[model samples]
Target: MLTTAPFTELAAQMTGRVVTASDSDWDAVRQAFNVTADLRPAAIALPRDVDDVVAAIAYARAHGLRVAPQATGHNAKPLGTLHDALLVDVRALQEVAVDPAARRVRVGGGVKWERVTPLLAEHGLAALHGSSPDVGVAGYSLGGGMGWLARKHGLQASSVTAIELVTADGRFARVDADHEPELFWALRGGNGNFGVVTAIEFAVYPVAQLYAGTLFFGLEQAGAVLCAWTALLPDLPDEMMTWIKLMRFPDIPDVPAEVRGQAFTIVFGAFLGDEEDGRALLATLHELGPAVDTFAMAPPGVLGDMAMDPNDPLPYLSATALLDELPDSGVEALVAAAGADSGSTLTMVELRHMGGALARRVPGAGARATLPGELGMFSLGVPLDEASAVTVQAELDVVSRAVAPHKVGDYPNFVEADTDARGFFDEDTWSRLRLVKALYDPSDVFRGNHPIPPADVRSL
Candidate 1:
């Protein structure tokens, strides 16, 4: 049997808070942002800094327990169970440092894009951050973060220069290209199967302004707008990036009266060059005569909020896939599944165009660099009741099957609960990840969000 005496003693020595099931706040401590995950971990440790993380790992090891590190818990659905493990809450480890001369920034495990983006903006520098500012930097980078500047800078993981982590053996180590080279490679895009990262350092870019905004049109014009946008995509420079979203806002007090219960098609984009040329390039989209237009020149700090992602926690189901092409047939399939006429109570349906810098794989960088397809397809369902849940799920299945022919696997960061881990990587890449998992986490002490099993367990 596992001993509790040592755990009690370890908790007494920690500078951070350690809560057990008996604690009044245990329910809140073990909760994830998605709300679907009702995790009941043996203990939840909120580490304030790097030392606290080290101590938590050591204590878990002594008691023969696993450690699962979580920052914002954005992608917690894939984390199977934590009954025999300690959930390391690193939200208090918020540290951010920027070196403008070297064009690099260092962030703590718990740091969010919201905090770092503004800090880097002071020096006219920008880090590759995901669409939402609330997303944790470490978790996002580990999963191959896709950002607004991705077309020019590439995935967030590609810019990583170093990682400081507490390994399964309770040892603190620094991994980089020149140090622990193999481990560094796995840590980049391999997810968090190796250890509890304390801090990560990556290069940033010198950017001050960008022409970005969203244009909205009624669902009646979706077909025409979608076709025009797709046709115009090829003519745009590598500095331009865009996506199309089909949304049906709910009729509620929280939603604006103007768009409440309204179904519309919106085109979102950002251009990296000067406003004049950017405007000229996007003039055609303007001619399409969207019902609403909000394009403007904005500071780098505003990029995080551009996508308009909800900051609060809620119950939802999401799925993601890469699309090789979006022909007329594909657009029809998309509209038929989640569009206004589909009768699906989905909150959002998006098709993000991918290519440019996102198409070129960085050599010896990580397991994944470039997307396997030309676009990313994401759908999210919001079910208010059991019947609604069933209805949305059925519709999601129809959407998946309809676009199955164009799918070419999925992006790791976009992967969700039901997706198989192997689908995120190719056969060779998955095999290499297994070996790396064996090397760093032989006993499988760290059970991260999307785990890569050890080599020995693959055959079984």
Candidate 2:
């Protein structure tokens, strides 16, 4: 059995603080980015550096406890239970080093997109970061990050040059294409299943500015907007990417006054080109006469805030799927499920255009080299209470059913629930991932949001 006495000794060997249930700040220390997640771990270790991470892993192993490495916990809902696990919070490992000349960046596990995007913009460079700037760099890249530049540059995982982590055996190692190649592939998309990642180095692009913005239409135009957007997908070039969303903005102080308490069908996009070409590409969308048009030639930093993702934690339920296609019928079904008169209280129902660079596998790509789909559908609802939760879930189900016929596969990063990790890979890929798991973490000392068991254990 575990006790506070043993933890005291373990804490002495580390430079950072260790918080147990008895600590006064236990509630704060154990909290996840999703307020709905109820994480009750055996203990929480706040690591300050690589040595601290090694110390935490050693302590967990000696005490016969599993370790779960977490940063911002954006996907913590999938962690489920951690009764016998030590939650290694790596938020204190905030290190950012950018090489402007080389177009490279090395960041700590705790670093978020918000911390680096503006800085990269100053150097006329940008990383393949997602809509939400608050998302951690390590977790995002490991789980196959997709963003505004995704269709142009592919996934951020492919850009990863190296990963520095402490293995399950409490040994520090760096894996890349030249060293521990198989392990390197697994870590890119296998998430935290192998070890506690301390730092990651990746490549960035020399992009100072781009033509990007949004077009907002009344809720009544949802059906028309989606139909036009679907037709426009085939002609869009690799340098351009777009997403259409049905959003019902809440009436709150945090929300912009102009959009608060309003519902709209929004079309947002980013293009790695000049204004004339970008505007020509979106000429069809402009003909619809949107209520608001904010398109302009903006700096790369503006892409970070264009999505307007919530800055604070909120209780919400979400669903996602990779869609092969969204025909006219699918658009009609979607409008009937979540449009103006559908009676859906869901906060957002979005469909992101996929393909272009996202469809091709680069030379040194990792496990998640390419996502197989032309469109990615994501829907979510904010549930404030038990009654609201039920309504939100039912509406989400309806929206999901509408697009069920076109689903090709699922993106592991967007899958927010506990599920078989094998579903994310092919038979050959699954076998190799398990083999790598057996070689490095046979005991399964580390647990990721989507756990991948070793081959030996699966055979048993």
Candidate 3:
């Protein structure tokens, strides 16, 4: 029923590369972020601009092909990689422009946070970016990006001023609350269901420097450190942000020999205030005597150096949950399941503190009708062993149950290999997202790795 003519014509209209089954590089191009998500889509369109994206959508609709959009090919990469679908790799659209006058930045959907971060830093500005700079801006914000700046700036979606999208019918449209109100809302916190976003204009902050870095502790001191951290967080200035990571680095050069190849308690921090004050505040942390305390007040780029997640292509899978409470029982369960000691093969388990700016939603800003409430716990489950992935999940589930009653929702970005995330979020959010899907992409022609539940479907 579909003809190659439309695709051929559409490909000619685009500036970037177009890959098909006949191409020699097709084998390597189809796989999404996770090396394991290798599926044979009908074709892959790497469009350079909004017009190209629009044409690709037109061709896909004519050919009865589904569409998917990807920026970084990470996260529910399915959020971008359509299965047996026409994959639109928008990386060529990558561009970052800062509007100092408006205190905003307009970035191509394909641009990663890394590309945007340093540019903003050059201008004494900062975007409420995610933890890792590798994630695509669109996919990251669509999942309510609860990243490092979250405590100070709230959801990244909340800051978006404008968005350009290529819709189901191949129409290019601009999105803002006053414009396509419903679709705008859905694209913010809702997973990619509305259309293929080409670029986004969002707010940034004047974050010139900060006292920030990580403090690594021996596994034996996890409990004492956790208590000390809890006491410190409430008292610390809002400028400071912190998270606890229980992970083992796999004996890599960048990793320390003592902490590498084993588990440890690492305190990740970002102190936005003066260095001396920040250092003084850390006195208690040092008194606890961590095995490796790498704490310091630093410049904008320092955040990247401290967390330093691997940029190399990695085959990974993860899961996440938001907790309303972290009871003593929950702590015990986490320690029991994930273990206080880090011999487990899990790469990292990150627990971010939410609230502060994360709690306040901008008035009439976006169609982000959904977000978890204030001051809850969050957890990430990363599996290192393919054979043991299931077992690792079982153990993580134990940690999850330790605080299940308090689980409000799952962080969309962390919904790794699992595609059944409909059960993780709230119903209102789902309904709102579906309404946006109807308004902007009624054909359901773009079902990718992360399929938005059809509006008519039953709830999980």
Candidate 4:
């Protein structure tokens, strides 16, 4: 446990409040997006601005404390958990400024995409932010965010105009493609390995709304839907992104009577272009028999309902794989493992179609995506008891092996909890990342979320 005595002097010096277990709000502070991450951090420092973050980090460094930088807390993560940890909550750092003329948005690390999306919409523009509006802008973008408009704009990170980070060694640096180039490479997909990113500026797209939402089908029809969906997605325009989801809507009156409480296949899509062309593109899917057709013009805020991903944590565990070829054999393995009728207690199996604009990389994109195409990405959401993490991992291991022939760049998100920061990047990638980390964070700080594993850890 962290003693308050040693840090009382330091706490009195900062503008942000320093809370400990003695505070009545300690329970609230300990709560994470995923309830599984129930940990009492030694100090919860609410930094009101970038200067506050600097002060908090300096205090941590002075006391040899571990610092975990967080915003929105939506990653279902475990990077900052120790009782002795210094929790740097960046929520007060929220800022969203749109350079409408330049087609860009410079969002503070603490800002949620929801705040920016609407502001951009006012200018008849939108950034390719993730589905969850509750998710932080900088945190998600740094992971190469994937979302509905992703195909049209490419990786969110690729849109980055600049990033401002407080290096581990306690120096503030603003990096971009042209300046501090090495640090820029690691920031894109290196997770939060190098330092605390306080602000990020990325390119925004002109988009108001789209033909988006779910088209649901019965569980029995999942196989047929998957086959047809895969064949149709590759022919899609760059302005559209498509995905197939196998899920079971809960039995509740709030849910429509048609899709409530039954295993179903929901085709969720987003078309970034005009409506008429989008409808023509989706004519084939519209022909398919759906129990419920919630597909229509919708705002970005409600997009989460389409995926129906739980906002609250239950016993959540998931594993995913990137595929090189979505051949019949691979599809067969997928269906057998987590299909509609596969009684594996899995909540949903999602197959996201990649490629399209995704193939075009920034001049020197950080992560060398091993698999590049308009074909596949796998997501299986399973909810079982906490004790079943081992069993779920074992089952997922089998599934990963079954599709090993298709392994590509791992999703920092899909399998986040399963792999530590070390395993997130491959050897060559991690090696290059370490050299950059050493250059920026020479004092061995930045050991929080999506951390750069130690030189020893990365080498192994």
Q: Evaluated with TM-score, which candidate comes out highest?
A: 2
Q: Which candidate achieves the best lDDT against the true structure?
A: 2
lDDT of 2 by residue, 154-269 (tens): 99999999999999999999999999999999998999999999999999998855999999999889999999888999999999999999999998898989999999999999
Q: How accurate is candidate 1 locally (lDDT)?
A: 0.83
Per-model TM values vs. the true structure: 0.95, 0.98, 0.89, 0.88
Q: Model 3 Cα displacement at 277 (Å)?
A: 3.8
Model 2 spans with C-alpha error above 4 angstroms: 1-6, 457-460
Compared with the true structure, what per-residue lDDT tens digits does model 3 show for residues 1-460? 5445435677787777778888889877765667656656678899887878887888778777878777667853454334446778888887778887678888888888888888777777778786777778888877677667777777888888888887787788897878977777777766666678888989888876687777878766766676676667667666778888777677777676666677778888887787788778767877887777676655676564456676656666555677655655556556665665534456666677776776566786454523564344444444557767776666666666666766777666666654665664566766767766765666687664456755753333
- Score candidate 4 by TM-score against the native: 0.88
Cα RMSD of all models vs. native, in order, equals 2.1, 1.4, 3.3, 3.4
Candidate 4, residues 1-460, lDDT tens digits: the string is 2355545765677777877888899888667776666666668788777777788888888777777777777763556456666778788787878899999788787898778877876677767776666778877877777777777767887787789988777788899989888888888877676777899998877667577867878866776777777668768887788888767666767566866777877888888656677778877877887877776776554543356655554445556766555666776776776665566555566778777667776576765332254555555444456556766666566556666777765666555563565566677887888777766665566655666654544454
Rank by TM-score (best first): 2, 1, 3, 4
What lDDT does model 2 reach?
0.91
TM-score, model 2 to reference: 0.98
Worst 10 residues of 3 by lDDT: 373-382
lDDT string for model 1 (62-171, tens) is 88788888898888888766778888988888889989899989989999899899988788778889788889999999989888888888888999999999888878
The superposed Cα distance between candidate 2 and the true structure at residue 326, in angstroms, equals: 0.6
Q: Which stretches of candidate 3 lie above 4 Å from their native place?
A: 1-9, 76-83, 252-259, 279-283, 340-343, 373-386, 417-426, 448-450, 453-460
Q: Identify the superior model by lDDT, candidate 2 or candidate 4.
A: 2
Clashing pairs counted in every model: 0, 0, 7, 1
Superposed Cα RMSD, model 2 = 1.4
